[model samples]
Every structure is written in structure tokens, then in C-alpha cells.
Target chain A: MNNSEISEQGKLTIVGTGPGTDQLLAPAAKQALLEADSVIGYKTYVDLIRHILPESCDIQAYGMRQEVERSRAAAALALEGKKVCIVSGGDAGVFSIAGPVLEVISEEDLEKLNLSIIPGITSALSSAALLGAPLIHDFAVISLSDLLTPTELIEKRLSLAAEGDFVVVLYNPASKKRTELIKKCAQIMIEAGRKDTPVGIVRHGFRADQNVTVTTVSEMLNHDIDMNTTVVIGNSRTYRKGRFMVTPRGYAL
Target chain B: MNNSEISEQGKLTIVGTGPGTDQLLAPAAKQALLEADSVIGYKTYVDLIRHILPESCDIQAYGMRQEVERSRAAAALALEGKKVCIVSGGDAGVFSIAGPVLEVISEEDLEKLNLSIIPGITSALSSAALLGAPLIHDFAVISLSDLLTPTELIEKRLSLAAEGDFVVVLYNPASKKRTELIKKCAQIMIEAGRKDTPVGIVRHGFRADQNVTVTTVSEMLNHDIDMNTTVVIGNSRTYRKGRFMVTPRGYAL
Candidate 1:
């Protein structure tokens, strides 16, 4: 194996499963899971790939809001000379488990365990593909989950992204208890004079009950949005073409 | 076949090859290419997957700076009922061929040709994986190539992204003649109080001669940056840990 491959002594591989779809999962990520002695993740994300895990592979699935706990478990397993694979639903590097797992490893076992992060298809790009190419230019991805970040900061980002003419992708737009963040985000964008901008709302992308809608930013709040939804608000140049929403790359065609 | 699969007709499938690595390529994209009658892309990207293309598959590799011509060709080929696959080195939706191909088809043949876009690992996410999850928070992806976008707008986006505290990823950062854009972007970030932010520079990510460096934003310009490099500037919470650059997910560890 090359230098990029993990050595024999207890390695931790963080894999992104790519929108909970088997087909979207990268081959490298699949191989990591197949080779792992223990696979850990949130219960919902881990359930998505249970079919691919071997029977001998230990499946450690935790419930919601146990990110730190799962991360610590992953690091501890690797330190015990077990090849551990921690799974994240989308790309692990983007608002996912890689950071938390790395933080846990950095605390005490930085040298004993080998760490590798495998990239996956993030929701922004997957949603953009389903709605036509709305992120062809510069774009910003912000999560509306105020649990980690301040709501005011999220609002500021929405405003700035809109004013900069960025195609903005919003993850974790809303949850059951926090239903106002998406509405607030829409207000911030509209306040920045983006009321007419095209917005694509994709819920459970590439999964069962997947719904994709291309509408204007003004009408975005009228649709169904939840924690599973990914919202893409277009730049000034984005427009709807028949069933597709496209942002031109300014080619002189 | 599922509804997601194309019918037996002329179709255009835009595939993201994921940092030019076969292992990183998604199964959906690989399936699309394997079922394709003809494959077309920029010479560099096309050559990356040449080993996977069947001997009976017709290969059309175009030179650089021919995006419009290639998009038109892909659309024309699809209109004639040949399953054509256009490959992009990274995710096609991000500053690649998807938008151009969609735009070319939207002009007149929107209803005639079948189009499907399969997501892949973008350079930002792939480079972030190599750099140890520097993009675990909100991030902005901006391309420094001014071939299609105005320089002033690109500069404005960089400043806003920095001011908003987004981990910024720079794509197409510099070429032989376009060195000043990245330098200018560094100045903008520095002006926005990101001078000391952690910066990760990844060249030829997931490929031979891959180089990954973790440095501060102030020292980012001293690296060997070129068009093939992806630069990730960290947010205020990002820091270097041993060889890995990590942005915490605000989890109380």
C-alpha cells in the first residue's frame, strides 16, 4: 500500500456515506467499512448502510445528539488496536463527525492511532444536481441549526451571502422544535433584495420520499422544510429553464 | 430500472470523477460511464478515467478552454440518441461542465435530450479530508479564475466570506498568468481579520505527487499554489493539531 493507506496498528477511518444512498457512496468509503473491525455512527446514518456491513463487523449505533459520545467511542476503539470506521450521512468534513472525532483523537491518542478521512458527496452538490446546476459559480454553505452557531451569526451569513450574489446552500434548515430558522433565513435573503431569486428545496435527497421543488425565494417559505431538507438559493443570474434551475457560467454562447 | 435511470435513448450524463482517483469515484458515476456509448471531457480529466472506459467506447478528449464547445458537442451527441458521458475532475456542478452543458441544452433542446448529473467528491471536500477536516463548519467555495467571472465580483465575495467568518475554499486559485488573484484574495482575508487563520493548501489532491500543508493564512501565499491546488482557509475556531488542521463542530468535549 502507498503512504496514504493506513498502517496495521489500529486505524480510524471517517467515511461519508453520501446522502444515505448506497449508490452515492464512494468505493474507498465502502472498502473502509468492509475492512473495519468496528463501525460506529448515529443510529439513523448507520442504519442506512447496514446492508453492506459484514456480520462480523461490530455495529455501534447511537441515537440523536450523541456526537461527542460516538466520537470518543470511535477513538477509543482505534486505540485498542481495532480498525474503526465512523460513518457520517453526508460528506464527513462538512458539519459532520470528522471534526468531533479528530478533536477527540487530538486530546490524548494523537500518536497511537492512525486517522484517515474519506470524502463523500455532500448534500449541496447532490441537491444542486437534482435541481439543475444552481451552484456553478461561487457559493456558500450555511447550516441553519442554531444549536452550535448563534442565530444572529446565521442571519448575518445569509445577508452577506445574498449581498455577495452567492448561490447559498442551507443545511439543517429546520427541525421540529426549531421551525423558525428557515423563515428567518428567507427574510434575511429577501431583505438583501433577493426576493426573486430562484430557490431549490430538496428533502431527503436521493432517498425514499425525496422531494425536489424549484421556486422563487419569495415562495420558499411556503414549501415543506425540515431538518432533512437542503435549500439552495440562487444568485442574481440564476433562472428557471423549463423543469431546471440553472446559473449560467457567463460563457459567450 | 428505477425512475432515476435514463431511458433507452440519447442521454447526457455528467459525471464527477472525484480528484482524478478511480477509488474515489462514486458507483453511480462509474455505472453511468460503463453504460455510456461515448465519453467526452477535457483531456486531463478524460485521461484520468481512461483505464475504466471500455475499448468499444468512443473517447472524445478536448483541450482546455473549450467548455462551451464541449457542452454543445455533448448536447448534440445526446440529441442523436447516443448515451454520452461528460466527465469532470471534481463535482461537475461546482465551476465545472454541468452548468455549461445544461445551458447549452436549455437553448432549444430542453425537451429533446435526457440529462442526469451525478455528484462526486468536490476538491473542497477532498482537500479538506486530506487536511484533516478544516471545513467542519460553514464554508464558502470561490474560484479565482476570472475567465468567466469579473475580478471585482470575485474579490467582493472573498471579502464577504471572510467578514462573515466562513471557512473559505479557493478553487482554480492560480495559473501561470493568474497569480495575482490568490494574492489579492489573501490580502482581502487579511483585511477582514483572517490574517492568522489556519490555511490548508492541497495540491493534486488524492493523486500522485499529492502535497498537503497546514499553515496560517498569512503564510498561504508562500506555498506552491497553482490551478490544480485547493486552498482552505479556516474559520475563527479552526487550528492546527499536529499534522492535521481541524475546525471544531462546537461540541463540548
Candidate 2:
């Protein structure tokens, strides 16, 4: 059946593929992709899930930093009575496409589009799984990409997270042009008296090329990390146990 | 082949079942449960996945607050050459079983047993998806269950998170015994100038009886919330767009 004949309103599924791993992908997300008439996402994310797309499904791939455009295009397609899926690497609700999609669609359009967000294993949780449990206690997640947010605001959040003794998860820590933000973040944590806190750097988490490195806040700069890495700085009670980096849950036992 | 004949070292898999929904369960977690010789978890979580367990697998169920005992029993079973799976609701790494499992096992035991953690959709992400993208910006996750964490510490973290303008996700917000904690949390947020901030309360998140309510910080206490609910309080820029609660990602556009 064609789009118009099948239903009056086409559905829009925002799918989070979960750290680019098939095993980590929720069953609902996989089912949504299979049922989608078209899949739209960043080129890199599209490549990650290319194998799973149905042969008849249309593919619309964009380059990085085209999130807004991609979301709008997906919404437009959905409004045209086509079942569309906008893909994100981790949980779509976490610094991903879900926000932008919601932002662009008006209230009337949203009601007509039949939108649903399928959650996935975010990088923070996936990285924590690989590095023991650094998120066992209260934690904060901050993105260091100053292109959208001001550097001063990022710095302020970092200092407050450190001061609050949160196990801070740093996303988009460093890119080609933003190479020094991670260092500044580490400096803020060091100044907040977490100089010796345990930190785990996980690159390409849950992928074949995954790399896990354990270091201290003061020594974080010595590692080779980039935008692909998720850096987890431990709280005051975080420690090293054998090869694992662990932050104890606040339990009396 | 029997466990001893197949391999000398038994396997232990810590699985996150993801908000009590089978569709939300990761494929890896489902596979791990099916392949296990025995499955162990809190009674509630074990019940959540009982239908998916293999017929041959033994099930060990424990009462609430038996996390340490459950992990120890699971570890001991693994040491005896049984493939064991310990389950947790939501992501095991986030305020869940991964920490206790790692803490209970010794270095030698860890090396002797094959251990793996399969990530799942955490309540924070699932709740965020259901409430729209309140987590698109920097966020903090704090558990208000002061049973383990002192009330003073939770208060301090709440104050700092508010001061930093971080989107906050509150887990274990209220229970029958802890009826007043959630009220105190709202008061702190209000005092920090977030009196009108958007708050989303998600109960039974992905389950059949799931409930979602959107309210302001000042009116949060008027809603029906319990420990099963995950509360998300928006930052300064959070707003109600239609039925969805959204927090902007700070894009320049």
C-alpha cells in the first residue's frame, strides 16, 4: 500500500542505535527501523546501521553538524504521509536529534506526525559498563562542545559539578578545533580538589576499536582522546579495583 | 556439554532489563539471560523477566534491599562453575547491580570468572524520552533515597545542581516511608529561582501502567508520585511545547 492509502497520518520514529552496536540497540528501536519507510541521519550514524535497513527503504544521509536540517527534512517527510525514522548514535533524548526535532515541529504538526522516541543505551551508561561502574552515585553529564554553548557556561558547569563531587561524564570532550577544552575541564576538576580522582577514557565504546584508559584528573591530558571518546571522572570515593575503575554506591554496607 | 566440561571458568552476566519492558530490553541482555545456567535478581526484577528465562535455568529471587546478598550469591554460584546472570532494573551500571557485583568479587575471582555487563535503557533516558528531551542539555542525576546517602549530602548536591542550571533527574524520589523528601527537593529548586521550572514525573516508565505528568516546580507536590516515578526538573530554558516538555540544546541558530 502507498503512504496515503495505508494511513492518514505518517509516523515519525526517533531511533537511538546505542553506541553503534547492534547488541546494545533496544529491540523497539530495531523494530522501528525495520518498519520505517525512510531512514534519515548523519552519514556516520547511517553507515553504522546500514546493514539493518530494509532494501525498499529510502536513505537520506547528511554530514556532521546538519542535525537541524536532517530533523526538519525527516519531519517534512513524515508530514507527507511517509513513515520516517531519524537515527541518533546514542540515546536520542541525550544531546541528540530528539530535541531538535521537537523544536522544529509546531504543536499542530507534532500532533499530526505521531512522534515517538525509542530510547537506547547512551554512551554514558555504555562507557560506565565497560569501565566498571563510575556512575554508581549521583553524577553530572556535560558536553564540552563550545560551538553551541559558550565556553564560560561549560566552565561554570564543570566547576560546579566538581564542587558537588559528581561523577562527571564529559561528552564531545575534544574535537579538531576544540582540542583544549578537555584539558581545561580537567584543570577545573583539579582546582576543585579532585586532582587525584580516578578518570576513565573510553573511545569507540562498544565498537570493535574500543579503547579503555584509566587515569587521574591531573594526568588526563597525557592520554590520546578526541571527540569520539567519553571521559568519566570519578567522584571523591571512586577508586581502582584491579583492571576496573569503580565508584562505590553510597551504601553503609 | 555441562558447565565444567565446556569451560573451566564460569561466566557471570549482569544484565539491565530496562524499565520492566521486554521491548526495551537490549538484545544482548536477552541473549545473556537465555544462555545462563541460573538467573538471580531482586524479586521484582526477576519477575519482570521471568517469561523470557530459559526453561532449564534456575531462578533465585531475593527481597528488596538484598542487593549485596544477591550479588554475593550470584558470584558464589559462578565460582562453582555455573553460568549466572544477575539482573537489575534500568541500566545496571547506573545506581544498580554493577557496583555491588564488582565490590563483592575478589581480584582472583574476577579473573577466574568471565564477567560482562550488558547495558540497557536507563530510567533517566527512558523518562526523558517519554517527557520529551529534557536532557538535551547538561544534566545531573541524583537519587533522593537518603537511606544510603545522607539527606545533607543530597541537599548539597541539589543546591549545586540548581546553582549550575543543570537539568536534574531525580531517582527514587519518594517512597511510603520517605514521603517528605520529594517536597524538600522541590523547595530547594524553588529557592534557587526555579519556582516555575518544568518538571516531568514518569511512573512505571516503560511498563504497561506507565504514567507521565508535567508540572512546574511549585506545583510538583500536588501530583501523585512515588518511588516508581522518575522526576525530571528542567533548567532555566526549559519550556512546555504542546504536551512535551523540552530543554533546548543551546544551538546558535
Give per-residue CA lDDT, model 1, range A105-156, as digits (tens): 7645887778889999999989998998898999999999999888899888
lDDT of 1 by residue, B74-94 (tens): 888888889999989999999
Give lDDT for model 1. 0.89
Please report, in order, the local distance difference test score of every candidate based on alpha carbons. 0.89, 0.91
**Model 2 interface CAPRI class:** high
Q: TM-score, B chain, candidate 2?
A: 0.96
lDDT of 2 at B226: 86
Candidate 2: tens digits of C-alpha lDDT, residues A128-225: 98998889999999999988898999999999998889999999999888887888998888888889999999999989999999889999999987
Q: Quote the chain B TM-score of every prediction.
A: 0.94, 0.96
Query: Which segments of candidate 2 are over 4 A away from where they belong?
Result: A1-6, B1-6
Q: What is the lDDT of candidate 2?
A: 0.91
Model 1 per-residue lDDT at B225: 92
- The per-candidate count of clashes, in order, stands at 1, 0
Pick by TM-score: which candidate is best? 2
What is every candidate's C-alpha DockQ against the true complex, given to 2 decimals?
A: 0.81, 0.80
